[model samples]
Target: MIYENDISYEIRGAIYSVYNNIGPGLLESIYESALDYELKKLGLKTKRQVVLPFHYCGDQLGSFRLDLLVNDKVIVEVKSVAELLPVHHKQLISYLKLSNFRLGILVNFNVNNINEGIFRKVNGL
Candidate 1:
């Protein structure tokens, strides 16, 4: 298992709180909104739909938006799928690398148990 930092731990708690209240089978947007609200309620700074610009050899490339950036440290990707696929994990990893963030949490809100749907991804860990 990868080591989890304090920010990641707090974000995990916030994710669990949202999952416990909201349950499952909801759309990704819904979970995103609720998790943003929950993270703020926990006194954590959060930015939603944040655009992360990519760069290549001093050239500006297109950017991708992140679902949530918590405390400017952890990237939180919300998904409401039947199950999390490798592509989903890869997506988060790409976001983490682009954003220069070390930790990311991918939460799928379509599972019977939230624990089974939570994934912690680390970049260069």
Candidate 2:
């Protein structure tokens, strides 16, 4: 199994490549598709728009759709909004907790600087 850090590093690289080539001002789904392509081109396994069942205390609740699940280790949440709100970060955190993943990346592709738009969140990483 690939370590979370290694997978994260590759994911970041893919993010930068997608941003550099496409720039910004695209829809979230567009960036999501591009990033998924880039990641697959980089020889990484990815599942796009994955719906993972959510449960609570042994009861089946609703479900959440992850933008991308990389190598089944890292969760990539893509956004293309004017600015990322706290709820966006909180949502990723909640997904990590509910999905039992250790690492996640929240990226907004609507900013001038992708660096500022990228955030890494961990659930006990």
Candidate 3:
């Protein structure tokens, strides 16, 4: 068994619930919204469209919006595309690095099997 943090395990269960109900071929926003709802229903504190600002030389750069932040502990990046590329994984890693977060989940709701599409990434773990 793969050991995960409590929040990660809960987020995975929530994602499975959302994907099982909604299936595939939907837009990313659709999955984002649905997953957010499912996560909330599971009693996990969720924040959508959270802004993570970039910095350079102690200067504030632009920011990127995270799809969802669960319990302020895990970053959930939702995607509905043909496939998840390395860039997708990199993007999640970037978010974790920028926010100093330890865990992140990259979920692609475009696969026939949601389990095949879910990815868990850890920063400094």
Candidate 4:
């Protein structure tokens, strides 16, 4: 099985590819589409806007939409904001916990430097 770290590495490359080409200040949806396209071009499986079922005490509650799920192992949360807030990080963490996903990449593509805007979040699963 491919490890989460390995998948994350490829994902980082894809993110940079999209950022470098598209630059910043685009809508989150646009980045999402472009990143999805890039990942596919790299021969990686990606599911966009995936609906994750939410559960509560052994009951189905609602659902949360994941921006992108790559290779069925990594979650990619795309954002285009002036700055990434604490809530953005928390949102990815929550998705990781809820989905039991091992790794997640939270990317805010509205910064001058994409390196500073990308974050790798591990769920310790």
Window of ten residues with lowest summed lDDT in model 2: 116-125
Q: How many residue pairs clash in model 2?
A: 0
Question: What TM-score against the true fold does each predicted structure earn?
Answer: 0.92, 0.96, 0.93, 0.97
Report model 1's TM-score to 2 decimal places: 0.92
Candidate 1 residue-wise lDDT, 39-116, digit = tens = 888888899999978888988888799999888788899999997889999999988887779999998989998889
What are the clashing pairs of model 3?
none
Instruction: Give the range where candidate 4 is weakest over 10 consecutive residues by summed lDDT.
Output: 1-10
> In candidate 2, what are the lDDT values of residues 1-125, reduced to their tens digit?
78989999999999999999999998999999999999999999999999999998998898999999999989999999998889999999999999999999999999998899889999983
| Count of clashes, each model | 0, 0, 0, 0
Q: What are the runs in model 2 whose C-alpha is more than 4 Å off?
A: none
What are the clashing pairs of model 1? none
Of the two candidates 3 and 4, the one with more favorable TM-score, higher being better, is 4
lDDT of model 2 at residue 96? 97
- Cα deviation of 116 in candidate 3 (Å)? 0.9
Over the stretch 14-97, how does candidate 4's per-residue lDDT look in tens digits? 899999998999899999999999999988899999998999999999999999999999999999999889999999999999
Give the deviation of candidate 3 from the true structure as CA RMSD.
Answer: 2.9
Worst 10 residues of 1 by lDDT: 1-10
Q: Scored by Cα lDDT, where does model 4 land? A: 0.94
